[model samples]
Target: MTGLAIAFLILSITIVWGGLVASILFLRSRPEPAEYPPGGVDDHREDIGPAERDT
Candidate 1:
């Protein structure tokens, strides 16, 4: 029974550790703000200057 308890404890610890590592990796792999520039079709056009819109 002790062996089973130890094995379960190890598995729980491993799962928690794996979750933490995965979260860190995901955060690290996130794209920077510069990676995706602004101004898609749905973006606010009113904010742009009149000269820019004329171009």
Candidate 2:
């Protein structure tokens, strides 16, 4: 492959793999919340206050 093509290939691969590694590290450090809010999908907005919600 030409030099520019090789450079772009390397750049794309680095971006994809770098994002995967960064996300794994970030999630490992902060982790997801253990406890979800009381409501399931339909009523998941229970945590929002009435004044802030649209009618």
Candidate 3:
């Protein structure tokens, strides 16, 4: 095998392996779940008044 071919092969393998490892780590991580109470929408906009009608 030529030197250039060997070098290209090694570079490709390293890049592919690194990408696989990163994907696995990202998939393993978990995010916290959000909680919402009943009547959540009402609680959010209760203080805002209705829009005024145009003359």
Tens digit per residue, CA lDDT, model 1, 1-55: 6999999999999999999999999888974443434665555687776554454
**Which candidate, 1 or 2, has the higher TM-score?**
2
Give each prediction's root-mean-square deviation over alpha carbons: 8.9, 6.5, 7.7
Poorest stretch of ten by lDDT in candidate 3: 30-39
Candidate 3 lDDT, 1-55, residue by residue in tens: 9999999999999999999988888777844335557756546877777789998
What's the C-alpha lDDT at position 29 in model 1? 93
| Order of the predicted models by lDDT, top scorer first | 2, 3, 1
Model 1, global lDDT: 0.78
Q: What is the overall TM-score of model 3 with all chains considered together? A: 0.50
Q: Give the Å shift of residue 43 in candidate 2.
A: 9.7
Sorting all predicted structures by TM-score, with the top scorer first, yields 2, 1, 3
Measured by TM-score, the strongest candidate is 2
Q: Judged by lDDT against the true structure, how good is candidate 2?
A: 0.84
Each model's lDDT: 0.78, 0.84, 0.80
